[model samples]
Target: MFINFIWLNVFLMLCAWLWVSYNKRAGLVDVIWAFGIALNVILASLIFETAPLMVRVFLAVASGIWFLRLAWHLLRRYCHETEEDTRYANMRRAMGKYQHLGFLAFFLFQAGLIVLFSYPMLALLNIPMEQWGSSTIIYLVVAAIIMLVAFWGESLADEQLYRFKQNPENKAKTMDQGLWRYSRHPNYFFEWLHWFAYPIIGLAAGVYSLWIYPILMFLFLYYVTGIPFSEQQALQHRGDNYKDYQRRTSIFIPWQPKE
Candidate 1:
């Protein structure tokens, strides 16, 4: 059922992308629907078996809240956006006649990401949560704090970038203010960090999956649908300034800029 659910999304998104790729952008509606679907999958997973009811409930609430928040933020920002995400635009351009294949690859990759990071939610139903211990409590507390910090960082970074781009004078300029001053992609960093928190909570609840969280982060930051390809698009669009920014700024970590 889980695998089928995952593939259902992948197939639907792939089909949609084929028709919409040339005419429109991926919208917030789709993002919200995706989040809701993922949450539903996780919730359904909990009902099948495994884990103390309290533990499963707690993890489900935590994950559901986080996902909903992310979906809200993304939806609001993309509300008026008509442009294809630069990532998709560049992808379409580079692939040209092979854009259909590119769409399938990216669509499936996204579904895979949704499934991988969601392992904690799904895997819990396969393992008993009564195995939770004192050490797991510590991990959960620390993870909760990290969740706040990561989500906050992502929020501030996005707000700063948004405001910067709003100014006519800064329209053509590279953003180097606020969180952007510290990291080239603060939002992406937090997005990666977000996945770690879930696994920690899952671990705390005595729910474990084989490398699900780490693999999700690794692929998101390095390969498939992540930064390497993204940076290439940025370089082409932002010109040498983005290249200079890359040299001076941390690619994935948040820190004060060097003097």
Candidate 2:
């Protein structure tokens, strides 16, 4: 399969870090810290080795597209912005003398996560879950539709926020219109939703043994990088307005804002 071993993941992580470092953005890497995830985005395909040809193609293309999207989104988020992301500033200070150690630990753990998050890739990579039949086409079409929904949701959310940020008048306030009106973190919510398509299609194949795909995403959204990290940043930046937004808006699901 495309992802044979953890070594590939490690290599990918290092490459990401190297790219970040080359750009003099190692600090950004420390803060936004996206390299670890690229590995997950790619390694998820390791499971395709045993999957049906149709299933494998779907997984590979889905994952490839997903990674490209995420990579572009994050790069746009972090690149060219000189702000130290606040998240990394505290982390770097906390690391102190062992900051180098912190980067290593963070990168390695993210490598594992890349492995962890790519469960659909593992589930559908090489497993003969579906044959080239009507079922396969249905799976592909469904997956593609879900993927488009997910892609659009994320892209629109990011675009809206980017434009909001660009407007000089919107500074120091919370974004409570557009997609932001419904979900406190529209981009992140959709980012998690994107993972659902994989399993919807992966299960259509035959790999049900690994359920880590959905569970980890759920956990990540609530506990890890999703709400936890974003909320922390929001509290620091937006303060009371953000708190009100959180109280009125759905944390995970998309819905109308409180009237």
Candidate 3:
């Protein structure tokens, strides 16, 4: 399973490389990154064929919805924007002559991340339904509730931000409305919540190590790729407005804004 996972990412990364080489838009890698995880879920279910049919189907549907929405949002942004995202553009400028190599490295790094995020799904799908026992019902209920809430929260956050951006009056202003008021990164908060659903489901299947999935996801979002970069970009673009938002709002977990 590990070998197949590596090979699948390698192929996906190669495709991303070719696409970026032709279009010179390295930002498309973000879209590819989402789809890669969706594909991983489907492939893992098919290749393993050990987990309960219902479990596999539910996972595929849940993850598919999440990734597809994310991918579509990113794809539209990529299509409409004339220039690369500032994040990748900055990386390109920093790399100078080694920009292409840097992008390749970035793509590969994201591919690894896809595999890492898929661990809980892989673990859950390997456990057979017969072994789930009575706790299975509890697990499924908890997982389903968490996943639904998290997905809905994320969608709402994205929608609120999108609508805010669409308004001319909101330009250069900090978003302190709706979910954004409670947390500076409500979207990331809910995204991290989504990972917990898997481990809860895995727990019912007697998979102990699945806790690592949410832990890794939290670390990645909090300390690595998610909040740090987003806040940096916000600070750069929105300046004092964003700083004020940061002063009053929670960074990851949603809470009432500070007084």
Model 3 segments more than 4 A misplaced = 128-130
For each of the candidates, give the backbone clash count: 2, 15, 0
Best by TM-score: 3
**Tens digit per residue, CA lDDT, model 1, 1-259:** 6776677666656665665665656453347344754576456656666655554565666667667777776776676566877765676788889877766676767667666556566665556555666576577677778777877887788788877866888754788888888888898888777667766766665556644776667675767656887688777778887878887888777776766
**Runs with alpha carbons beyond 4 Å of true place in candidate 2:** 1-5, 16-50, 129-134
Give candidate 3's root-mean-square deviation (CA, Å). 1.7
lDDT minimum window of 10 residues, candidate 1: 25-34
* Estimated TM-score for each candidate: 0.78, 0.84, 0.93
Preferred candidate (TM-score higher): 1 or 2: 2
lDDT of 3 by residue, 93-147 (tens): 8999998888888889888988877777887888876777576767877888898
Candidate 2 per-residue lDDT over residues 186-213, each given as its tens digit: 8878887777776666556554554566
Let me know the TM-score candidate 2 reaches against the reference structure. Answer: 0.84
Q: Higher-TM-score candidate among 1 and 3? A: 3
Ranking by TM-score: 3, 2, 1
How far is 112's C-alpha from truth in model 2 (Å)?
A: 1.4
